[model samples]
Target chain A: MSTGPYNYSYIFKYIIIGDMGVGKSCLLHQFTEKKFMADCPHTIGVEFGTRIIEVSGQKIKLQIWDTAGQERFRAVTRSYYRGAAGALMVYDITRRSTYNHLSSWLTDTRNLTNPSTVIFLIGNKCDLEGQRDVTYEEASKFAEENGLLFVEASAKTGDNVEEAFLETAKKIYQSIQDGRLDLNAAESGVQHKPSQPGRNNLSNDQQANKDNCAC
Target chain B: MACLWSNSNEVLIQIPLTEEIDNVTFYQISVKVGEIKWNVKHRYSEFYNLHNQLITDHGVSKDILPSKKVIGNKSEPFIENRRKALEKYVQKIFIFLRQTMPKIFVDFLDFHLYDIYFLLQDLSLLCFTKGDLILSSSRVYSFKPIELYAINEFLKSPAPNFTNSSKQLDLGPILDLCSQLDAFIIHGCYNDYLKSNIILNKLPIDLSPFKIQKGLYLSNVSLDMVTSLGNARETVTTLEVVFSNVKRISDILQCDILHKNTLEESQKWKVLETLDLSNNNLMDIDESINLAKNLKHLILDNNYISTVSDLTQLPNLENLSIENNLITVCNDLHRKIGNIKTLNLSLNNIVTGKGFYKLYSLETLNLSSNKITNIEELECLGRLPCLEYLVLNGNNVSSSIDYRVKVLEFFGERAADIYLDNEKPSEAELDKVSILSALRIVKEGKTPDLSMNGSS
Candidate 1:
């Protein structure tokens, strides 16, 4: 375990949201654990995961929360929208109903999260190419109109999952560098830590736990 | 006769020092012989010399006035009256402008007096009333020709007070304007300082507690501030009350108290079939089960509920989700009341197969992310005749495809469509005698053949 109280220079809180069965948990699991969870259960209320990744030689720990995608769960998941540094709004490529509900989900995200919170739109389950319902062009257009970052990834194949998390972190780090995201604000969701020895091991244990429950 | 005429005209020649020189040059005036003399240098030749110098300096070649052409034939009396009325209107505008202009600009205005003549020509076409003038001066701080028609129309109406018109006025026009602008009609008082006076509460009866039309939002409101809903309760069906910190259901249930003496009181509570109380601080399910009689969809996802006992009383409940609770045993779900179509027990502490035997009418069962290892535990769900979709995504069911198929085939013909991984059953697994028998049972709506199927 890392002896230092804080292992990373910054902590960024992320939220994964989308329609039901859209692979929100799968995307989070793939990025944090670097493998697919075949029997990963559907999310209930909100699931927690953390991973330490280095960006520009600065250790950054991402504390991600994956929420239930059902419409009814929106009432409880809406509270998690506040204070998010990065939001991963996902939809299944195979499901049209999930794609259709993006606007309402976007409205909730925009209303609840702070202005500086970066929202990224993800189209999950791209591995199931046969069951595709929503086209990429339409989803991209929707993302463009709403000023959100977008990508299509497969959690089963572990494709572009790392890029989604890394891109969000990079965007947030850019905001911090440009002074758009204030590090001192209590709800900015970014924390700066001093460098210390053996702190990387503590993050490893956290990562191991995340890998064990990467669904 | 010249002396008498000069003595009378002296009273009419009242020009300031600045205008006197321009008057002498432009009109070629002769001095009054009987007027009192002063030491001021007053020379007629000097005035002509100044005029000649000004003409040279301004590059004016011709010493002639511009022609004043009539717009139409002036022989008719109507045309003559129209021209005369137009001239008088122009003169009145000049008088008003002269009265309002700064003292320093009086000389400038006098030098360029012809410009005011054209401005008055345009002003003659517009109609003005007292209300129009007041509204224009109040709103447009600066004078402009753009608002003339709007101000004229506003003035022609009997009631001109736009802000206070809602009290004595019909809401038809206001609603039309809101619709045209695509703006929401907020009825109650907003607590924010910036938005304090933006929305008015002038209706005879308060519509605060009333559910606004669909896709409308009403937040941060208490139940007591509302009086009556009129017909809004029956019209607007979908209601969303989020982030209002509404911990108790009593705030919305106050409608029951208000209609205590009414005959059709219970119908009010039954109107709301979809209740969303997900993020509240509810420890038990008693309040929701008692109040929500006609509720078909109940979402208790993130509450601290430990058991499924509170849900057995709901007669019409179809979709029930107690996802993130302290439930461990599947037996707790066996006592469910209605034929629950979907049961979400995804993130619970259930480790054994004892609890899966209880839910009989379940179509979709989520037992993913639990601590269950073997496929034998799910065989208990073979009794569920309606069970079709099963999600075992995060469980430790056997790794081989055949083992997964063997476990799924335990449900016989009514075998629930198992969602284990990215894998579906192969032809060999589907062709197994026990699996075939189970499919026959599913088609016939009979119990699975336990004798032919080997025990786990």
Candidate 2:
């Protein structure tokens, strides 16, 4: 989202999914392009964006996929849930129905991704306090009971948008450091580039030879 | 620079009023694009067909538009609600499709006369009127830059500011301009290709009755005879004879009401370059293709041609597209289309690359979506010296982990310049290819190139 990810150590795939018209695309556009899309139409299928963010001194590229059409096109969005390292499940704070639909969205996220996937709950439209329908207390409690990381943010005012994305990346990077995520697993949704330039000559050759011999 | 704002699409729908014609009630919906506004007196069924065409063609959701009513459709409340729904539908579709507005959507709004597509119709019509001044024997045919550049920029000089530019063309007469300009093309115009620079923007009907010299593009509409004794028949360059339901090429030309001498013993389309015969029922390439002795490009997509036959006679044919056919064999295809540079055999039933070695001039080859299953079946492609772009996308071998690297190995180190599936080799892919190359050298009982380091 912040640009110049042509050089990065690892790529973490993220999917920002929520009900239709819940400002999911606005949140992503605010994070990536650093602008408020004033009269943006909700995306049809899937819109993709990327940003290079430094996590624990490592340049980790976050490839985010923002999607639309929940019930109208669930079949297309379901395929994106897989191979996602982080899932930012969003809901509009002004609309209680969007908040109440969080359980079904969380269920799809949990059932599709691996157990190590970091899911963060986001209560969007926090700037609209007078129109807020679902209180922050109940949403935080719902996140606690469901064992999910949660935040109350505003895509319109760009509040806590960075925290919601970076905190999830930090947790995913923490899992890699703790060795909970097997790097060799293809479905891990984390690609760690080995011997990234100017560091290894002998080791990279040995690694390629080892892979070739196995093949 | 004086004021700043976002460039957003603003859609306004005036309150629709009910008008009755004979006994049927209709909605006169008026919508505005930018500063230009127009009214459409369309029935709900007509709106349904237009919006449905846009959705089906452009992949927009069909649920945005309002549904028809079985009861109380003419009631004031129902009319008001449907008007709001249509407004929202137009707003949403305009936001999503403003950049690449589909033809159906533009036609629905009658914006074609104001948008860039209108330039093509205007330019063609203007050129035809100018061509009337010179005789058919005149060799000089060129337009002054002022004639083309200044008039073409009629929309831009005032710049119908897509946001607020108020320049407008009369919306009513331009509605039927397609059929009217099509009449000009069919109004016995010779060198039709040269007059319009060979690009006609989607003519809707058949032009079989008249003399079309350079290009004859007919689609979906059937024809009794493509018989024309035009003076420019000897110099006709492009001919697209698709979906006319003719089995033999002679069926297109063997009948003529005006001139029997044009077909009598032989009809030589001497310099014909392009012949498109798509969505027809031609079972095989006809021997009548020898008629276009200098033909360069032939498109036979969506036909029932089961074999690669009768094409060897068109010696100058360089490009051949036989996609979506029942061609199950290409064992001797190189003998037929050997000199062709680019070949599209996608969506066919062919299973092997046998006899492809003789296709030494081949450059770009699309064998995707076919029955090619394994690597050994395509081993003969490595022998071609000029194979640069190879597309094997829907084949079974593509699912393998190192499928890209294995395919690039066909070109050895020259794989660096080769493109597979329209993608340039990534750094990781090139790394894998180098390892495969080293392994191949080792398997041949020779010492591997140890001098080649990983960084290199």
Candidate 3:
């Protein structure tokens, strides 16, 4: 029995959220397809995409859900926040309103999702330098104050887009390396893999997976 | 910061009844057990009827039940005393029910009588799998048809068939609806029992790759392949290719290294996206890679590719990693890689930066361990409008006097922003660099002019 390609060690669920036109869907598209969709339509409820990435010599599959940014859409999008391993809080650099709405979004994310959810703040549309309204300093400060990973990215030019996604995965992988995130927690957004012949001891969740299997 | 569900060992204590009329005295109670709060109100006759039913059916005691006082029944103190007594009585009944009738009593406590019925008339228009669903509970007691539909369809249904004749239903939309109601119940109303628990435990059934195998094997396959599957489905695109020592580039392109008959194979390297031709004896690729038009990332690390002759043929090429190559001079790398964003030319013998002059869209450039001597060599990179990140470590220019300042000056405004060695220059560092570079530039220019004047 060949295990085939569905053999990822862990599945990390991610939710991308922000104000309208902040490039939440565009970031997901660029990371997954490596192409900029200029005329990409706005997401209504939630859009799903998956990309397999390698971090610290470990392959992680990212199940990313790009959510709608409209104010009314939060009712539908809030549910997607729970159990997320990573939450990419996107905001348009060209619009101060989007950046201003960061606290409310953070509040919803903090309230609904588990504490282990890696909250990554993204200043999108970095390529639109001429129309830039939000500075890197302020965004970084807000992220630091709120205890979030921060990066300025461009979905169009694909600048720091991969890093935004990969860095989150790297942090999540580091959490797995450290025992900070409990794999046994149902909403921890992490699944421990069973040990095999060539399995390494780096991942300490082998015993956890074995015990879960007994359930 | 707790997870969605907390292990606070919560139990519904005193449910105060609120409201009163002719024969029915009302009780309004707020039962809070940790984060979960249930605000319930019931009339006197309702409790009386339940007490009567319990006595008739289960032969339970009426001693714990608060007796209805006849004197000063409408007075404030009398009503207050009755409310307290009723709360204690309800708590005793719930405690008794916890040991005797757990499921039925819990189910009974979850329902409210003043039901708000909403129309599911737009059910046909709602596309669940398409994820076009939008449901909000912020309207303040406004009816949410989607939440009502979810409760009616999935949670309230006897046995829900979350699938069609062929494929199973996608649980994303359902979960979205469930969590919305759950959040509303927690923060907003606290009256309606958000039937999210049923969906929470049941939705994972659809995600089980092994058809509801309770102990689904995790990490059964290579983590590498799992990610590969995410990018390229087994039936569609090719994700990775690892082959070595090709006499001709066409040998690997024809899939001869992996499979024998290339022509017979319908998917003959057409879907091949990631081509890792590392540790090979390849000198140059001359436009034959046009077969894989969809190739986005091409890795030629540890090869003898002295010059990437014609990578421009692959229109979709965005990433080209040719590290550890023998390229002495990169003349037209930008010409061939018009769309290339990340170029890893580490450990190469590149002396000049003449090749990167036309790379206007380059964001990340890695030219580490090269023979770049002068800062003027990196001046060509200034033309790159989108160059936000660069790594020139191990180069002679890196150790030159005021290297960071010179680099920052060369890139101008972006110097302070770009990440060098995986770190953005701090605000203080940027300020210092700008000041130092200004002094250095003025000093160098003024000395050169004075020396010319003295010589004249």
Query: Which lDDT value does model 2 have at B404?
Result: 88
lDDT tens per residue, model 2, A83-184:
689999999999999998898999988887899999999999899999989999999999999999999988888999989999999999888776797667
Q: Which of the two, 1 or 2, has more TM-score? A: 2
Against the reference, the lDDT scores of all candidates come to 0.54, 0.65, 0.61
For model 2 the TM-score comes to 0.39
**What docking tier does model 2 reach?**
incorrect
Query: Compared to the true structure, candidate 3 yields what TM-score?
Result: 0.32
Task: Count clashing residue pairs per candidate.
Answer: 13, 4, 8
Off by over 4 Å in 2: A1-215, B1-209, B225-232, B253-265, B446-456
Model 3 RMSD in angstroms: 29.2
Question: Against the true two-chain complex, what DockQ does each candidate achieve?
Answer: 0.01, 0.01, 0.01
Q: Please, what is the TM-score per model?
A: 0.34, 0.39, 0.32
Model 3 chain B worst lDDT window (10 residues): B212-221
Candidate 1, residue B167: lDDT: 26
DockQ value of candidate 1: 0.01
Native-to-model Cα distance after best TM-score fit, residue A72 in candidate 2, in Å: 63
lDDT of 3 by residue, B159-239 (tens): 323112222223444444433331211011212334322221121111212111111111111221111121121222333
lDDT digits (tens) for residues A110-187 of candidate 3: 987887789999999998899999899989999999899999999999999999998999888777667688788966
